[model samples]
Target: MLKFRELLVQSLLNDKDEGEEIEDEQDVPIPRKNAKSTHIMKKFEGNARQNRKRCISCYDKLQKEKGTKEARAKTKRVMTYCDECDNKPAMCLECFNEKHPSKYF
Candidate 1:
């Protein structure tokens, strides 16, 4: 074991003398692509009133057409939710696609 340790130390000394630098695996920086903004659409189950969430885009359109009060009262409710979107907005399939064009179903 002592002989093996001496040989290993000698080899490391030789490598240093030869100007070969040993790189630690953890010290290396990994190359990564720019992070993409993505969203995952999930569906709510059961027929409760709490499950009936309004589609954000539709609600926005309604707000523009009518007003906030009227839009809140009249906007159609959907069962889908986008996890990564702001406020985790509820959206229908079409609205989800329109909002996140880069994401595929």
Candidate 2:
């Protein structure tokens, strides 16, 4: 299966470059596709791999959208698992906050 990042990049590549520069007051074309790709690339440009780590909650949410029973349950419960948490690989934000308020403080 193609990864989401790969798909996004591929889509950006497949899109035609839009716009042309005009010297006068004529409409100047801005390369929206290039700008969009740059915006997305900027999101993943930083170091600190941890920052690049995918959000488990977000992944689970996507899975739920795709109709996974387990993911659905997780969503209905309004929680998500995060490996950074002390216990399980997943835990909802509310539970994490409740359990680790001191850590945050």
Candidate 3:
């Protein structure tokens, strides 16, 4: 079996060759000057399965970085401040929820 480092190198080389092939093919249909090269972002265009796998891999990496076996928090928090209560930059989700209820708004 190929070692991990060799596998990574092979993948990188394959990616470079694929990109070169694409560039060569593009030149055949249109002149380089009139190509109007545009880079379309494809991060959100994958199917559900690809997206789920990517998410799982990212979550695993994050958990390893955090060095915690406990399930990560699902809630998303922003570096925001509560104007009503003294402006604190690191306002957590729980605190924000407790401070502002549905009826308050």
What is the lDDT of every predicted structure here? 0.75, 0.42, 0.39
Estimated TM-score for each candidate: 0.55, 0.22, 0.21
RMSD of candidates 1 onward, in order: 13.0, 16.7, 20.7
Find the candidate with the highest TM-score and give its number.
1
**Residue pair clashes in candidate 2:** 80-92, 81-90, 81-91
Best by lDDT: 1
Clashes of each: 0, 3, 0
Candidate 1 residue lDDT tens string, 4-78: 454479787774456655455466554423233346798888875779898889999999999999999988788
- The superposed Cα distance between candidate 2 and the true structure at residue 13, in angstroms, equals 65
On lDDT, the stronger of 1 and 2 is 1
Q: Please identify model 2 stretches exceeding 4 Å from their true place.
A: 1-46, 49-51, 67-84, 87-105
Ranking by lDDT: 1, 2, 3
Distance from true location, Cα of 41 in model 2, Å: 24
Scored against the true structure, residue 31 in model 3 reaches a CA lDDT of 32
